[model samples]
Target: MASEKMEGPSAPAVRRDPYEVLSVSRDSSDQEIKSAYRKLALKYHPDKNVSNPEASELFKEVAYSYSILSDPDKRRHYDTAGFEALEHGAMDMEIDLSNLGTVNTMFAALFSKLGVPIKTTVSATILEEALNGTVTVRPLPLGASFSGKVDKQSAHFFGVTINEQQAQSGIVIRVSSSAQSKFKLLYFEQEANGGYGLALQEDSEKTGKATSAGMYFLHFQVYRMDSAVNALAMAKDPDAAFFKRLEGLQPCEVSELKSGTHIFAVYGDNFFKPASYTIEAMCAKSYEDTTQKLMEIEAQILTKRNDLRQFETEYRKALTQFQEVTNRYSVEKQAVDELLNQREQIHSSFTTVRTVAGHIGASNGGGGSKAHLDDSRTESQSDDGSSDGKDKSNKKRWFNLNLNRSDKKL
Candidate 1:
């Protein structure tokens, strides 16, 4: 498939830089890069920057960059080829950027070069034209043969006559099917009409009646219709001047028969008993024309079968590869999902720890304020000078105990 598509006129187009659009360095880790993308995305989001075409365009660019960078395979591709590599995969599995206007033209061209086939349906009309044709016969000099009607139980005879003037130049003759003929040729004899001389002889070598429809062989001969010698005796004798002793089934030819009036006799058997069979003589060119057409049709059929088999083999191979790729994509997507979840968990935990630390610091500050208030109260009360020292020592002990506990907890 790839080889076939490569025969097209042009290759796929290249793509622009995704990393530059996202404003991230190639070495940026996933978290830092994604954080930067979020800040840029919010600033340029179409909703936030309504009626701003530049911001809207920037938003689209940011989204595209983030999408590819977020995927491991896509990121690897972008890193390796700086965005051009995304065009090389099959079309069905990707977002067809061609459907998007303007800047997407490059993507469409890129996909075409990747050997992605443009599918088309073959119409029935076109298929019919490919599979069918008519045979045409070219003009040739008309010739004579024999004509007769035969049935299941009997042989038939026809006397053929050709112009004596044309006798020297031999002609081709055909005995072919005429309306509803079922006769399967067994033998043919051309002899003078005067004989009742044929005697039945049983030969074990002869097969029984046909069980299927097909061509059966016949021996052809010719005899002058005016000859007096017994026709059957002439046919029985090997030395008899026979037409050619040729063999054929109906709708076919025997080559080179002399031009003269002659008695032609045919003997054949049939499978299904039909009412009657007609044999008509015709020019051999007609037979040859249809024969060549039939051979061509057979060759075409063989070629079509081979093509269908090859298509089936290629389809199966493509399906297998597609399945494998899909499975890999699924696994990679799952891993990315897991990583995102873990990142969220870590972020949430960090936020919780910061909130707790802030609360602890506020509590410590409140405890220190209360200690300063108590010291001021003791200094004010110390004018009596009786338990001032003891009170100061007690206050110091209480403050130290609370501070020690708070420090331990921290």
Candidate 2:
């Protein structure tokens, strides 16, 4: 009998390249994988394309790719060994994907470009099947209290997601700064379930308390939306301005520290605090680097302020010159009017002389002393009857016989 073909168990068949399965780079971000799954699902979902059963197969692949890549443990294992290293059935095996809704894939653009072949719903179904977790609904009564210290045990990142059934569209959530700082926080909201989710490892992460006045944490918020979608970016301070962009959805992504009593007013509006709880922390840098960065920023600000002051001085000087020019313009206008009036008077007096000079036939009529009409001007020409008006022409004459005169003033 022919040797039995090397048959395998009903485990997931390993695809050529896990990265190619997800249609992403080897170093793609978690958000990128999630986004890719969503797009692939829409394309290859059986429900989306009834004529294409192949889409479902592609969908299953994308789901599997995202599932294995997203989990840190599984990704590490896959990296070290070939596909066989993971528990055999682990590839196609069913895993819970729902409860991790708390985790958001902020990068929407990267996935659409991954060039995967699948439908979105299929991918979602695959995802929904792969990473499902238990979700607990912790409801608090109106005016209830829930507080405590949440000193994070590690340097990793963590975040909180809140969903209110009543508000099913958009939910704005808050994350406090530190122990003594409360009112300042970073906020996030996603999903039609009215759930809010914040980043655990974001540098802008805050877990402080509210004590006194304006001096507090600053939240760095990035306002963006899928450039193609209407998803709105959270305003930097939520009060700043509305900006939107991104190719997928949730375009804006930045962590800003909250300030003032606003955080308390929103968080404790219905619930109070207790003694201890599951508050999370983020990957903060070593204090030295952070401090040095801040100092650099402060120095840049001072330098910029000095530059502005110099520019202001220059602006003021220009303004003064502008005022002076305006004054000169007014004076010129008055002078022009006076000159016009003087011109009229001179024209009146010289009009007759002008008329009389022409009557002299242009030469003084051979008498060498002709009497022109009207202001009947007298002219002493050369004895030869040539014109003799040279001394009166201002154009060629440079010497002044009388030098001590102070006659011309402008």
Candidate 3:
């Protein structure tokens, strides 16, 4: 009943085991865990205990615990890795409309407007009508089909009765809708009191194919739900009931069904438009008789496979080209790197030569002028004195040799 954001614990609250939080064992069945959560949630619900300051927190903890146990994937992860493996954002808000009072519903609606992802159960009105035998239910026999229009926010119910033999062989109920039709497939089981109770609900999936006339279609496959839990008790806590029912749900196998009438309801989910659809009930044997249609579906599969092969061929060609270009780029890059190294060496040699020349010019312009004058006088003297000329020639030869060595080092 609390209208808070219903998020996981943000602060470091006590990290209790989910099983302990729900007061159930780790090996408990899904139904047992669900029942425990419902009991705790109803007890700690904010609407009933307004004076208790801790009731809201207890309600959130109860919801979070159930969220982990309700999902098989999450439950397995928790069992293996504990709460650290479960992400806080993965916890979704689940509201049970049948269990909530008027005030709680008002608050839930207000919070829903604030963008919380609150998953509500089937409308209490609808469930009540179904229980009272007021909702219209049309009979759909095996190998037969019915077409109808269901208005927005409404549903069309059909009852399919199967005997022990048919139940053993199995059944497959398929529903197809016109282009862009949005609806849900709801399955129900008849109770001992001759009233139908909700069992499972599934959204329509696009068929991914179009007719020759270019009309798209949506398809539905009946999924079986566990009908062991009490429907009357579930109506009191629908959210928990919904999650429990969802666990282990698989495509309908009539062998697992009882020999009685089962209900299939097509509920329109479009915002403003009605849905036009055809519902068909077929035994598994009858379904196998549609050999031509099956072949057509197989042909579509083959075409898709061929298209995949073509894509793979093109992918390989593209990959080969990519590798060739990459190799070319690597070769070109190496050539460019070698040229850059040569250019750098040349630039370095030029810089060293310029530095040496600048030093020589500075020395010559300063006190080196007197030194040059002395060298000239000495050379004149050497010309007059042959012995001195020989000495000066030897010194000039040594200086030339040292300059050549320096240039070689550069």
Worst 10 residues of 3 by lDDT: 210-219
Candidate 1 residue-wise lDDT, 314-358, digit = tens = 866887999999999999999999999999988887666788888
Q: Model 2 off-target regions past 4 Å? A: 1-14, 92-410
Using lDDT as the measure, which candidate wins? 3
What is the C-alpha lDDT profile of model 3 across 1-410, one tens digit per residue?
11223225442245567787888888999757765765576567665667897886777678777768877768999899777677554354544444567788667666544533345544445655675678998999988989888885578999889898887656666677756475667776565577776655655544564101111111223333332222322444564453333333333322255568888888765444687778888776555445346447645654654565576578668879999999999999999999999999888876677788887997878877778888988888878765485787888899999999999999
Error of 3 at 116 (Å): 13
Clashes of each: 2, 53, 0
TM-score, prediction 3: 0.51
**Winner on lDDT (1 vs 2):** 1
As for candidate 3, its clashing pairs are none
Candidate order by lDDT, decreasing, is 3, 1, 2
**What are the lDDT scores of the predictions, listed in order?**
0.43, 0.39, 0.63
**TM-score per candidate:** 0.22, 0.26, 0.51
Give the Cα-based TM-score of candidate 1 against the true structure: 0.22
